[model samples]
Target: MAGLAVPTWDPQTALLIGAILFEAIVLYVGYGGLERLVGPRLMELLVGGDSGVGQ
Candidate 1:
């Protein structure tokens, strides 16, 4: 039977995980900013006029 073992610290794995987290955060913020920047224009084009909401 195998005994429970303590987790090992792997620098390469840690770096990989950190990079993925960083990329996720950047993508999230970048997409949100893009949406805020272009959402109104996109809606106007699709709706053919002002959305007419939030009056």
Candidate 2:
């Protein structure tokens, strides 16, 4: 494992990691919005009741 160690803080690695983080955040927000929009119906269908969330 020690032999596999690589340099850190290089620009390309930073950019790649940053892009992945940004994409993750975007997906999270997008899915959250979609859930907010239709989650109640889906939950009702699956759980057979209101999701226990106060409307």
Candidate 3:
């Protein structure tokens, strides 16, 4: 197969990959929490309190 060969596990590569994964998870949780905290207020300001606009 012409596919690239996988490299053997190394401490540096493990740390780097772990850091990236940790950052992604942190970002996801942080943004989700912020959205939960402020999303309703933002929607209210943008669309007003009726919430059921179409119905």
Best by TM-score: 1
lDDT of 2 by residue, 1-55 (tens): 6878876698999999999999999999999999998988788788776568535
Off by over 4 Å in 2: 1-8, 49-55
lDDT against the true structure, per candidate, is 0.85, 0.86, 0.88
User: At residue 11, what lDDT does model 2 achieve?
Assistant: 96
Better of 2 and 3 by lDDT: 3
Q: Please give the ranking of all candidate structures by TM-score, highest first, separated by commas.
A: 1, 3, 2
> Over the stretch 1-55, how does candidate 1's per-residue lDDT look in tens digits?
5778888979999999999999999999999999988987777778865576323
CA shift of 35, model 3, Å: 0.5
Worst 10-residue lDDT window, candidate 3: 46-55
In Å, residue 8's CA in model 2 sits off its true spot by 5.8
- TM for every model, in the order presented, reads 0.79, 0.64, 0.75
